[model samples]
Target chain A: MKKITIDPITRLEGHGKIEIFLNEAGNCEKAYLQIPELRGFEQFSIGRAAEEMPRITTMICGVCPTAHHMAATKALDDLFKVEPTSAAKKIRELMYSAFQAEDHLLHFFFLGGPDFIVGPQAPARERNILGVIAKVGIDTGSKVIEVRKRLRNVLRIIGGKPVMPSAGLPGGVSKGINEEEKQTIIEAGEYAVEFCQFALEFFDDIVLKNKDYVELITGDTYQHRTYYMGLVDKNNKVNFYDGLIRVVDPNGKEFAKFKGQDYLDHIEERVEPWTYVKFSYLKQLGWKGFVDGEQSGVFRVAPLARLNAADGMATPLAQQAYEKMYSVLGGKPVHSTLAYHWARLVEALYASERLLELARDPEITSKDIINLPTETPREGVGVVEAPRGTLIHHYKTDDEGILTDVNLIVATQNNSAAINMSIERAAKSLIKDGEVPNGILNMIEMAFRAYDPCHACATHSLPGRMALDVNVYDTKRKLIKRLQKNSCTTSTSGDGVGEAVSNT
Target chain B: MKTIILGIGNPILSDDGVGIKIAQQIKERNPDLKVVETGGVGINLLDHVIGYDRLIIIDSIKTGDGTIGDIYKLDLDDLDASMDLTPSHGMNIATTLRLGHGLGYDTPAQIRIYAIEILDNTTFRESCTKEIERQIPTIAGKIMREEQLCAIHTLGSPLCQPLQNRPVSKPKPRRAR
Candidate 1:
């Protein structure tokens, strides 16, 4: 027997690896996704002041700081047992909507959308932002960047977009928006709404109208009947900022609806030996391994899941987009993972519309933003629907308002099992008779990338800016091949963006 | 040229915060130079990066091949010329600058990237490890000197002073690790 190890895989953004095992027949047997873990976060937060969490948690991941900040602030509100004033809630939601809209748009243009915009089977070199720009025209990129700059500035006002202290405080925010600031938000919101509409039309023209792409989306290789989880408003409409957590069965039937404080009662984590991530499953369904369907406990979060778990969008244009999606994709709970991109577009539109609505609210410019807390501090849990999925922040504190413990279940963790399952299913479908296609890595990556799993601290994965890794083993557990896609220099020198290498 | 120093890193991720720390030190020494510290996500970089004639970006990178505190001055074109355009998950600096130029956003003409070799970026601690923490003043001074570029002296701004002789007090940790 022989073995080769890609040792010390650390320090890349969203650093993850896939290992595929082939049986004696040389056919794909099993595949697993492994991500490096960020250490000592609970220990790091144990002694911090309770109120500082809103600011501190923002540092958890540079990518989703606003999501974490919003979650942590809500947790503080619970800890002090005070409700935010009406104006404060609207203000917070306004900033949150901006964050979600900008984040989703970025994902569509740069992260996931390229797979469709540039066509999946295109040459590997032509499958990134530049490629997307080429296909979508230079103005699309310019529009995305321009709209994103405006929306991002609005997000910075509360979540410390430029790395200032957190403006979020318990019971409410620290301050209200002035009339001038509200005008900027309104204009930015309108611009985002227009861009998202254009984006949907682009999708309709490129993906929906194309027969081959439609078949690819509806194809079983990218489909799953897993339970879906999301946060929804009182009317069962998808809500990003705040709402009751909802879960729906594989058949698109309502299963559970609970507040953030009761999350532990409905959801639980299963620790697997092969990976550090704790895969989340529905508590009532029990742990049923990595299989999907009603018997399986595995549930998914993020765009597709949020839309599947809700009735409709809260805003009008988004509601139309939602209806059109279901009508075209064959109704509720579309099992196709590729539909996540479409769902992401609909949600972005909703977020933009909601931002405009809030921006226009008369109370948005009111001075009564915060309400000071008077209750004794203790334990509290906060929840918010991040662009990726539902994010939960749990905190326990001493009587003096100092944190005693902190636990976070980010979007990636909640979607971990489904992500792994999606990867394995794709690999199983793509590889046959022990023959692995050269393009199998991208094909398989498209499945999990749909979930946009950040692999937790993706705060930093300093593995020399590497992107994808795939390893294959034979029945004897011997290394057969290794494929790596890296754009980093091996040495501390310039001009060495290494090419993809495969060894057998 | 209106210049700005854009420091990029995660503040709570040990060595990853090195960029922010060095940027803060540079600002403390010369308040006249505009400094903005950010995690540098996607097009957000475009916002802080545009409207400046000259831009300096300092970030932490772990090639797993350099001294923990060593600084590497990188030109914009030296980046992965054909890779996906994103810093972490958004657009990479080179592609972003290209996009800015294409969009006619008044992007900086001269862009210098300072990548500090880092250790222990995976940890949740807000401060860098002791070894790297001890070298902050030296690293900050070196970057400031290189960035000053003699033009600031002609502008009547204070010269870049060696910070090694300045007070050697570390910021108080939220709690001892």
Candidate 2:
């Protein structure tokens, strides 16, 4: 028997499953993205000391630990009803900006970049960071590594470590930066800013210069018009560390802007039977069942959504990049899903610029970093624009600060509904009349990869890659084909495809 | 040799935290060894692993057909080094190592991987399952002995002495044998 295998499915075992139910005509009826979720986080949090949140939450993910740490620390600040000193906020924001820059750079060059940089139709072997290096030259790749190393050194200097930072306190950060440490960060920030500029030019030369790639970005197959959400400063500029939660309608008009604590008033989660991951949507609009556009409650969060929801970037260079993006894409609130990667680059520029700005601030080296909380602990919500998107940390406690309940609306959860929608849309648009092209797997994977959805909870085990399973069901409700991304593929051959796959 | 024992897993997840648990156990018997515990993967690992001579990575694996507490020792060659690490937060061990080498970062000269076959990694808890929890000390001892360090006596054993940072200080509760 010739080894019958699906190409991209075996390559990416990101633990993401796509179940496509086909109609009688062989067209896709429904496509469900079943993501394996780590269970009982709320149960895990209750009874722990509220102050331990910042440290404990960081362990929840292998990636985005910094994001979790920040959100949790902010939640403590809110819970204690204490405001951080100005210096502390700047120090925190500086660290956050560095993290965002490094993370976005990695995602672009490694995860999402391959689809466009190396060309989506490229061979599976060349669709990775190595492929990216092959195209962009070793010099750029070396530069990326250098820049990331410098930024991580800044993280180590301030956060005490790069992966999990213990610098956050209830009222403010645990420590402040001195002049020498500040100097190191300044150098890193300056170098990062330069690299981000190079990155924008690189994007122009690589992605934008390619007509086919641009069309794919703006194309309808990977597009969805949905309400966007993010954190915006008083001037309606994007801020990763802190800001009001802003929601924009599908037409790019501000729908609502409120404090982070008021998130419950706007957002709600809908649970589906097939998957542990809950679909979050606008509470006011109601759960309209995975539909996009204005009336549907389905909203999106993350890089693209942040760009769509915010008015502009905070820094000058990022603002110019932001303007260029909007002008090229035709307007605010770009509904193109693939544009998320483009928005990510724009945000990366802003993050790098913001890091430099914060580093240059004279107040960044102040000694007065933290303030003691006076009020008794109760319920509080802390929200930040994580590298992926809006991350919310909600905590309810008794008078003593023992956590009675904890809720974390991670970046991935916010985009779960939109991710499913994008996947289904791509599947429906690509899988016409039951042909079920093996090529469509990459197309569908590209849809989820746009958001860079990190399901690290259930993926802390070995193999180090997320597995994607594609199950295509016929009209008779029988399992026609099963592809176990990391293992093997068994097509619908009626000759015990299930048995042969099970044996393998 | 400047050996660094890296325990990679979510500490709160049952069985998933076996790596950290074993690292902690190894630390108990050999307090002077340079042991690092991290829930991070890919390039983030380069942050801790730079300048180390040997990297012994202990992680949890759920490969089918393995016993619950079975320990499988693997090297970099055992896994597909060029596997596409599209998702799962960052790059895999192979890619991270290659990237580190490419960038002229003094990554570990030699690497060893101890993948403990696990039963459950999804449930949110700080303790491993009863099956795997029992063999953690034995497993830790085996890994240390494999590294040419006597597990019983390390104070005057004249064995593997490494100098560095130990991030996670929380040790698992050890039972009397």
Candidate 3:
């Protein structure tokens, strides 16, 4: 048996390495998923003012700043025991949906779409959207650019800027939208809805045209069922902001539902020496490793998880898509992680429909957008369903509202174990005879990208000096190949181009 | 004609956010200036710099033995062939600028870099050190003056501010990475 290693996957966020160890017996010996550095954001946030957390924590990850901002705000609200007004909630939801649309678009088109469209071996220079424009039509490229701009415009109108919006606050948003701003949101929403629909059709066409890649879709089913968790309203509709925490099993069995403040009871985190990141699992079932487990405590979050946990989406189109997803994936408990992209696209459609509904709601245009908090508590926990997964922020404050402690569980952290599992499975199935099939490694990386893991914000480490190692072995447990790569291309300070190589 | 001033740094890592803070101040003073805060010089940097005619880059540099807040302005043409000036995430800013230049897409002709000398880069606190924070306004002022000079130079007008009167500081020593 031979071993193969690939260190520091390139064009991705954060610092992580995948190691596959096979023994002389031709069997898999060990699979190590290592994130070599620890970012103690929570520990360092102990003395800061809780009110500043929304902005402060937004620095955690550039890719998902909106999610961190929302979660931090929610967490502060919980600590203060303040509930935002209905209008405030709607505006916040709208802003988050816009962020989701933009983020998903970037991930799909710019980040992951290149591998699927241009083929994995394409040179890095030609592997981007520009390359897509060269190969496909200029129309597709322009459409992508147009969609991103519209989405960014929506975010700017709501959050005051596109990347990290300062609109979110403890009790409610810092400001409210005026008539003109509301109109802008409505127009953007209308355009976004139409644009998203067109993009979905385009993605579907891509999938249909490439029948060999259909397995990646899981036939419109919920792929990785495990246990689902998210925030859902009293009407059992999915919500990005302000809802109770709900968890369900693979068979769509409701196991537990708790208020956001009670999340500590259900979730527990485990640390491994191999990686700086920790694996969080359901506390009741105990730590059941990544691979085989009774679907009892294996929890999944983000778009797919949120969809599975909710009874139905607020919009008819989303409801229809959700039902179709359930029907296609054999009615829940999707074990295959690759199906997340489908769920993300479905949620994107749902978000667009929801945005349209909110825009048209007569109450949305009302000037009463913010409901301020009159008092403050010593602690709060804010939970929201980010585009990628469930995001939770817990903060403890002094009597004067100074932050004393901050705990954040981002979307990617919720899916950490599953991400490791998917990588291992993909490695085992794809790496053969010490040779990685073309696109196989890329497919495995794509599997991780499906989760859209934000390692930079999720983990605590500097940008450079990161390493990743992958090892593969044959059935006889003999080492076939070992691949080790660093993320930095030129400087050892880890401040260079992030490049990863798959060695045969 | 639209200007995007990208401030690149790791906020949690002390002075890395100097560029971003400077950009923010400029945006506040001049609403017309589009200010963006980025983590590093990567592919995202390339994306942000595209379409902007004037690029102002701010970052923290540990240039050997230079006093903190020493400002430096280097033309893109002066960059060495082997300089690893790219960011840690995507492509480097230098490469991106070069790429845009090669593509015949009229790259930013006026590029300015204001690098703050960092004493510490490991802290996770929000506020920077007293020395760096104090220099923010000074850096902002200097950048504004430079922009005026650039504008005047392009117009071929007589110097409003005497460039010779300002003390020419020594270039900071380059540290081995």
Candidate 4:
């Protein structure tokens, strides 16, 4: 049997490689996603002051710095044994909600939207944001840019920056919204809610209305029956910022709920020699490889997982949207991975509504934001629902507030095992008897794309965009075909396989 | 004419920070150039580049076509050849510009890219490779000459003035991450 490697998985914010082994009959036997690890992150943080973590740790991820910043700050609070004032909490949540809205909107329209909006089988060139604008009209594109801009502005006003926020402190945030800033944020949040509502309607009209797309969403290839995890408030409502970690089984039954500090007791990491990314599974259920079911410990996070783990949305409109989604999708604990898109929109609406609510609060403008910590520093854990999934930051510091040890469980790692399962399942099911159709690549990509994985930090960079090279081999482990982005061609001389086929 | 000198890269990632370092040098020499450092990619870069009459971008390139510290002066068309919509960081510049124009945004009329060939973008560090870091001022000077801005050497322009002190070595890299 020959091994196929798709080096540098394309269209995601990270560098991942998918290797599929083909049996003698040419059908797929096994597939694995290999993710390279960024070197020396733990060594990089050693000896750094504990207070600098919020700033330093946020740089770990380019896409979700706000999530890192929040988690690090909350960890700092726990480390110092201090609580933020009510005003500080509101201000922090305000910025966080805006970030959530911006991130979700980006993923849905720019990253993942083309798959559904422009049609799954659409040509490579037409399956992007430009194609999306072409189908939805230029006005909708402009509206997207406007809403995203407004949401970013809201983050800037509160966090004092556009991309990476620096407002988080041990006890609270460094800045608070003034009356004028409050009014501006209020308007922006209100607009965000409206924009998300419009987005939901658009999805309903275009995606749900199409029978083929619905069938694809509910298809067996994309379905995974496993545990789902997220953060929930006191009412067991979906919460992005501060809450206890909640896990639900495949049947939508509560598995366990625990504070952030108790993560090690409920979850465990398994390692493989082929990849640097550790596979995370439930501690109690034990590791069961890549299989998904109640028997298997494989679980997922991000939008769909968050929704399934929670009872309902916190806001009125988002609650309605949530109810509508479950009803249409055939009930709770929707196992379809493609439902992540719908769940993302519902989350965006919730984030927007929460932003507006926080913006309108009277205490949002209070000057007493930070409650300076007076206790000795030790170790603590902080958890937040990153737009991608649940993000956990744990740090150990000396009494001098100097960092001694640090460990971070990023959102993507939580779903890594499941992502591999999704990819393998899709690949096995889609590629039959050795003949791969034209759109096979996109179909395989659709499985992991739903997770919105971030691997840029994990892989090397090309000149501009990373080009994915898919190499197929024969039973003798000799190269058979080479399919690459932009120019897919048969191997001419090197690693000679067979005659050429140029699809792109 | 309204112009923007954009430096794009991940500052936390080793040699990738070269673009931003050069952009900062340019800003220090001539504050009137409207320099902006961004880690954003694809459409996010569009937001910063639009509404300007002319744009000059400094970024690190890994084309394997040149040696480390080798500089290439490219235009918008060159980027068109390098367009791969399936991107991890952000969209390629050409796609971003096209999207900006298609959406009826005010994209810059003239665009020039100064890309420095470099290695080691995967490491977590606050500084660029020493070889590339040494070329910051040179790259800054190249942009100034191309843009026809008042040179630091010969200038009584509004923003150009003789530096009271110039550090011989590369400036200590700040923790932008």
DockQ of each: 0.21, 0.27, 0.12, 0.20
Candidate lDDT scores, in order, read 0.80, 0.82, 0.64, 0.80
How high is the lDDT of residue A108 in model 4?
A: 91
Give the per-residue lDDT digits (tens) of candidate 2, residues A1-504: 011112233232225778999999999899998876788878988999999999888888877889999999999999999999999999999999999999998888888888888988876556777778889888999998889889888888889988779999988888889999988999999999999889889889999989999988888898888999999999999989998999999999999999999999999988999998877889999988888878999889999899899989989999999999999999887999999888898999999889999999999999999999999999888898988789999999999999999888988889999899888999898888777777777788889889988885434566676757788999998888775542222322221111121110
Best by TM-score: 2
Candidate 3 C-alpha lDDT tens digits along B141-174:
6675556533444455444243444446644658
Candidate topping DockQ: 2
Per-residue lDDT of A277-319 in model 1, one digit per residue for the tens? 8899999999988899999989999999999999999999999
Alpha-carbon deviation at A196 in model 2, angstroms: 0.6
lDDT (C-alpha) at residue A450 in model 3: 68
* Chain B TM-score for candidate 2: 0.83
- 2 or 4, greater by TM-score: 2
Clashes of each: 12, 7, 55, 6
Better of 3 and 4 by DockQ: 4
What docking grade applies to model 3? incorrect
Worst 10 residues of 1 chain A by lDDT: A1-10
Scored by lDDT, the top model is 2
Can you write out model 3's per-residue Cα lDDT over A189-280, one digit (the tens) per residue?
77777777776677667754676566555632214447778889898778876678888877777878898778899998887767767777
Residue B49 of model 1 has an lDDT of 74
Rank order by DockQ, top first?
Answer: 2, 1, 4, 3
